[model samples]
Target: MTHDPIPARLAALKTTSTPDLKSQWRDLFDTEAPPFNRRYLESRLAYRIQELVYGGLKPETVRRLERLGEELDGGDKRKRGIRADRDRPITGTRLLREWQGVEQIVTVTRDGFEWQGRPYKSLSAIARAITGTRWNGWVFFGLKNHRGRA
Candidate 1:
């Protein structure tokens, strides 16, 4: 004879009381029927096995669920809307920097060259201030220049 597991027994009890719980949840929302609340309850119940088997709550698991919640809560929709409003292609500009030292990213744009979070308003002005005719590229594509010869 096989013994029923504690979790299995608890789960059966929880399942049998779902309708009453759902009614209470719906009442809390001041609605005769709250589909969203019922869905939330279903999701919570689905994670019961993890909560029962694991001694402690997992931070990574919670973080992943939080990220999913953000996406489901219209975060991605807002980002897509913002991108659509911009209507400009993202520049293929790259950043050159060192991992250990403070480096300035210089972008040559229509307005001018921006360096270290400041706009120079002219490339000539930046060239005149830097002392060298050519500057080495340090960081490319978010990675350190391993060759170090740049």
Candidate 2:
């Protein structure tokens, strides 16, 4: 029968020093040893050890977590809608807005949005920088609207 190894891993995590933790991390994760704090290593290694022994979360559990995340982030990002919107927009199709008496403009790029000749990660980042607060980029630029909340 398969036995649970969680208890043993937990015990080792509590006793291991920083250098020992690095070695364990390499053995477990098979990645380059990181230079992290002892507490950080302990917590991460503890999590990984349990993840290995007990296996990962269920698919339903992951979906529930994703939904909770979307709700918390105030986005109901439908995959179909996102794909359709992305495919429809051509590069250089200018998105324009006026905020606080200043005209704001952004150009759609093959990879991402561009503003003032600078490549931006998201339009929301530009919106936040322009407004000095969190404003949904899609709503700010009239690309999308809050359809009765998430």
**Candidate number with greatest lDDT:** 2
The TM-scores of all predictions, comma-separated, are 0.23, 0.43
Clashes of 1: 2
Off by over 4 Å in 2: 1-5, 76-150
- Candidate 1 wrongly placed segments (more than 4 Å): 1-6, 10-17, 23-34, 37-40, 48-57, 60-150
What does candidate 2's lDDT look like per residue over 1-150, in tens digits? 987667786887878777788998899899966776688888888888888877889899999988886876566666425534433357889999998899999998987899988998788899998999998887788877676221
Candidate 1 positional error at 21, Å: 3.5
Q: How do the residues 1-150 of candidate 1 rate in per-residue lDDT, one tens digit apiece?
A: 977474674455456566865654454445554455555665554455345555446789889987886776666655544434132213435244443375545664555456666776543455444535533322232233555432
lDDT of each: 0.50, 0.81
* Candidate 2 residue-pair clash tally: 0
